[model samples]
Target: MEYKYNKNEKTAYQKGYRVTKEGIVIGKKKNPVGWLHTNGYRRFKIRDHEGKNRNVGVHRLQAYQKYGEKLYQEGYMVRHLDNDCTNNHYDNIDIGTASQNAHDVESERRKERAIHASSFIKKHNHEEVKAFHEKYGSYKKTMEHFNISSKGTLSYILNKES
Candidate 1:
């Protein structure tokens, strides 16, 4: 699944739009749109070489401005170094493969799972988990009984008080 480079979008960016280091896109008139996409990335409406309005991501635009068209031509995706979709700063973004992007997403998922486990642990102590485990008589059943999602979380809960 390779994505072809969008020359129209690139041309639109190069025509009169400028991206600040903070990821702000300024049009020809130097007006900031300050629009955000539903996925949290900065969005901009610009006219392409064909004079058609097009929506573009600030990260991609910044990457193009900083690294030129080679990235797009090579099928590399713009990735946020800090795994934040909203932080479009030029220095914080880079070009990477789709697999790398998927790894970044997995990293974010791990962080979310950790946060959820932490909150869950705070609400339910080790004694409760132990009692559930004893009644269930199996790790899988114990996890299901307590709504736990992973064996690592169950192990952590069981060992926290030891």
Candidate 2:
């Protein structure tokens, strides 16, 4: 079944239970504070369905950490070894800690930066980097787009439309 996006709300019915995109009412499926989601429907998390927050993707990773093993399709991070999130093939998915996952992402970012930097340096006639700010499209937009916590990484990439 196709999954739909659901906004979160302060559901009063349960402490941790929340609605999901599949219309299930999952509650505390797995967690100390009891992470909740709608039952039957495994499309979304309670927080996503009920919480009115813009930074949804920030903590969404945690839900995978909290309930990945218990949830269907979403189990084991469903990582795309090739770096595509939508590629849910079983061969691509694997269980890993958030920090570890972040490490993988960082490694990919570094590789991408290296490759892109080389191209930029060569194609742009060595005038690729212009004080960092201009090339990265401002620090705020860069961080938000990358879902990054550390602004310390000296990595760079061309935010191109693939």
Candidate 3:
């Protein structure tokens, strides 16, 4: 079955719990307190206010706590500045559009590619790579010759596509 997004109020009601600004989830009625359990991604289970158990990313919770409720809305996403999901500190979390988040991820990938390319260039001269490409007449063959794993980086170096 498809899962639903965690609604703060709804989850609190269904789980008989209330999450405080301090990131403490207190249960109500006969439910237990401090029942915050993390999934591998540091998400916690909450029976949504609709009575459906759902896992909420802790970073979102932390953002909610720090920025007040309603921090997340449709088309909005929570981003980790250090790209570490587990680091849910208030200062580390912020809101951004889905595209902005995607750009951040792409920027990180570009940085990695640049690093790999620099190392590859240091190991093999530009003339050598150009000759290898010319001899093979195939980007894939040139990549195989250079043992380069990122095709994007290879394209950037050979085709000047960035």
Better of 1 and 3 by lDDT: 1
Off by over 4 Å in 2: 1-78, 105-108, 111-148, 151-162
Candidate 1 residue pairs in backbone clash:
none
Model 1 Cα shift for residue 2 (angstroms): 9.3
lDDT (C-alpha) at residue 161 in model 1: 57
Ranking by lDDT: 1, 3, 2
**Local accuracy of candidate 1 as per-residue lDDT tens digits, 1-162:** 455556544775767787899978888888886587787887778777677888888888888888886666565788887789889888888888865765665655865665568566655566888888877779899888778876657766776654
lDDT measured at residue 100 in model 1 versus the true structure, 0 to 100: 73
Model 3 steric clash pairs: 10-48, 10-49, 11-48, 11-49
lDDT of 1 at 36: 76
Cα error, residue 87 of model 1, in Å, equals 0.6
Lowest lDDT block of 10, candidate 2: 32-41
Tell me the spans in candidate 3 whose CA falls farther than 4 Å from its real position.
1-10, 13-40, 68-70, 103-108, 111-162
lDDT for model 3 comes to 0.60
Select the stronger candidate by lDDT from 2 and 3.
3
Tens-digit per-residue lDDT, 1-162, candidate 3: 322454554444444544454444445654434333444345556665456767666666666655554454666677876666556566667887765664555676866765677465754465577778878888889888888766566665665423
Q: Count backbone clashes in candidate 1.
A: 0
Which candidate has the highest TM-score of all? Answer: 1
Task: Give candidate 2's error at residue 108 in angstroms.
Answer: 5.8
